[model samples]
Target: MPDSIAPDALRRLVLPDRVHRSLYTDPAIFDLEMTRIFGRCWLFLAHESQIRAPGDFVRARLGREDVIVVRARDGRIRALVNRCTHRGAQVCQAERGNTAGFACPYHAWTFGLDGALNSVPHRQSLPPDFDLKDPRLALAAVPRVESYRGFVFGSLAPGGESLVEHLGPIAAVIDNVVDRAPDGEIEQAGGVARQEYRGNWKLHHENANDTLHPGFVHESSVSAARGDPRDYAAPAYDGHQTHTQMLSNGFGVREWQSLSLTGFPAGHSYMGGFYRGGVLSPDRDDPVWREYRARLVARHGEEKTARVLGEDRFNNLLYPNVSINAQYQQIRVVTPLAVDRTRVTAFCFRLKGAPEALFHRAVRFLTNLSSPASMILSDDIEIFERVQGGLANSEPEWLDQSRGLGADRTEAGGRTVSAGLSELPHRAQYAAWLRYMTAAA
Candidate 1:
């Protein structure tokens, strides 16, 4: 914990319907979050597909810690701190590649693919009492590393909930995507889209499931796509218009009734926005959709295939870092760079045994929507930057997140749910954040 923001002080940063600005801009708070939240949480590291063969490795970041996820010769996946034990210099410099082991360029210390100490320069120069069996000679490994359906995650904390328990209801959401594969296997395909935004990381977290902003924030883009020119200079909605009982209608006037947001424990939540087009319809005449449906039916049977393909969840916020968009076959990994900067990498996946056209469609969907040149993502990033700037002022000490505050209902398994556009997701996230942020380390 940072001495600047003690545990007791952290409690004051959050309230029932608001959060202190310092939580977004304070360096101390960010450091505490890296330790208390990211350090302990099961953070997404690497997909099994990224390290499919022995000696393959990919660099990963869990908050402030740098880790290397490697496939060892023993056919086991291992995650180790990137630092070399000899001089605390990073052993691996490449972002990712297949290598027999990592050699620290600084001191020529070598570690095996599994992070075991392999050799050191000038062995004869060592003291007589020195022993290679010393654990300190090996690279430090993360305390916990586990995978759920090929998605690997690492935790710095020794133990608590298993990976499956941390995922909670989102586990079903993940299964819904992986099961879409005809062979029940999914692989990272095509390529990755990396982007950086000058905004607080929490902004993206809140914006992921924030339904209230789409119709307004993306209004210009939507109008452009429709070949209609909507006034962009119109004043924002007045408080009266928003507070009207008829307009509220319990969920605060949402445009998509089919859209639903559900909050689960451990700060996990999902936004269900089934594919708007006829993409998932088995009866669609499109050759790609027809072929994909047939392959799924052959593997999972007609009834089961329907249920699997029909699930079109938009964004599943796994909390802290990763967001999965099953509808588009995309997984976005969020990495915080600073209190005011964040980096996001979007990966597209292909369902094994699916047709080439299906993979092409998946790639096109993510490229058009999540790529750095994407208009949708551009709008989101712009808003995030603006929000960060706006919050720097001292006038508004509290940001209101009270939408649908009293309208949520408790569901089975302790999930809190509300209708479309409700702020239940935000409330649920902050509740978990406070619990994790202030809890004993």
Candidate 2:
């Protein structure tokens, strides 16, 4: 597999119901994906609340490119490549902080919040033709940055689909998350948890909507939770929500089949929520939930609040990089470090005007599912590495994705709906992957 894989060759790698294993194991294919897929897609960057004040900034990634997402003096959000124009050294080092300007350590070349070249230490040492205002001297800016409901996305390609167009029907999921906030705002809070695994990046998204895997891959946790004598539903019970979450995955095949999985255009997909009891349940009727419900009803009226809270979705994936669980105020971003290594960063948001306890629950949800120490995620990471190791073999070059191959049906909104355990989501993702990877330059 060459780096410049021809369009026809790329087409052969992905069939309607399966894909080549090399797509996951080949270094050259990963290199091509960094540009063709990650570079061109509208990737989730940072939420508006993260950079609320002028000079506020956070480090983010677009494929292999390190970027600084900042609020400039003009109060507009901007995404600039972290590299300084002089000698290509990173200009900003801190993970996140408010700074008047970024001064490169390699050479004191400073850039403003808007990525404009501000000053250089040895100005006179440069040639006389060196113009202070030269656009080439500034940090490179991501060509397009757009936001919908405070969720910002950036595209490295100079021109492509607009952010909304790229999001397709997936935009409603974001709207649902924001609408759940009583004040119609959500902020990144409780920091982030990052984990690295020795697996291809696509495995995360593939496993996200695979309902069948939980009963099998997570059998140990599920069994342990089931064997515990503690009554999770007892009013006086005090325990982490993670126990309830683990118990939720113990659902039998019939219950799992009852859940719906939907795949939209552009590789976006989501599954029906499965948590049925404990604080994790959407309709949990405890005092804290009642107070949060009252605040929401006061803000959006009873009907709208019910609708907002009633939208039961889990693991909504925005193709190539992000997995969003809007109902839980959780998001996980996938960053491909190499062909066999990837990093996932998870963050939780606080719903403005909601009860403080609700936000705490969200943080706990983030930690229980995504933290490096999480029992659930640790199991998945081990499996991912095992799959990567298994793929090293030369035999059986194709991975089948034909579970429920002909069962998917298109809905009125142009989205595909499949049985809960179907592999339609994987096929849908590969469809989008082929389109982007093989598109004419």
Please tell me which predicted candidate would have the highest lDDT against the true structure.
2
TM-score of 1: 0.91
TM-score of each: 0.91, 0.96
Question: Over the stretch 105-169, how does candidate 1's per-residue lDDT look in tens digits?
Answer: 99898999878898888989999877776888888988888989999999999989899888987
Q: Pick the candidate with the highest TM-score.
A: 2
Q: Write the per-residue lDDT of candidate 2 for residues 288-321, one digit (tens) a residue.
A: 8899999999999999998888888888899978
**Candidate 1, position 291, lDDT:** 86
How many Å off is the CA of 376 in candidate 1?
Answer: 0.7
Q: List the residue pairs that clash in candidate 2.
A: none
Tell me the TM-score of model 2.
0.96
> How many clashes would you count in candidate 1?
0
* Global Cα RMSD, each model: 6.7, 2.1
After superposing candidate 1, which stretches have Cα over 4 Å from the reference? 1-4, 228-254, 276-284
Candidate 2: C-alpha lDDT: 0.86
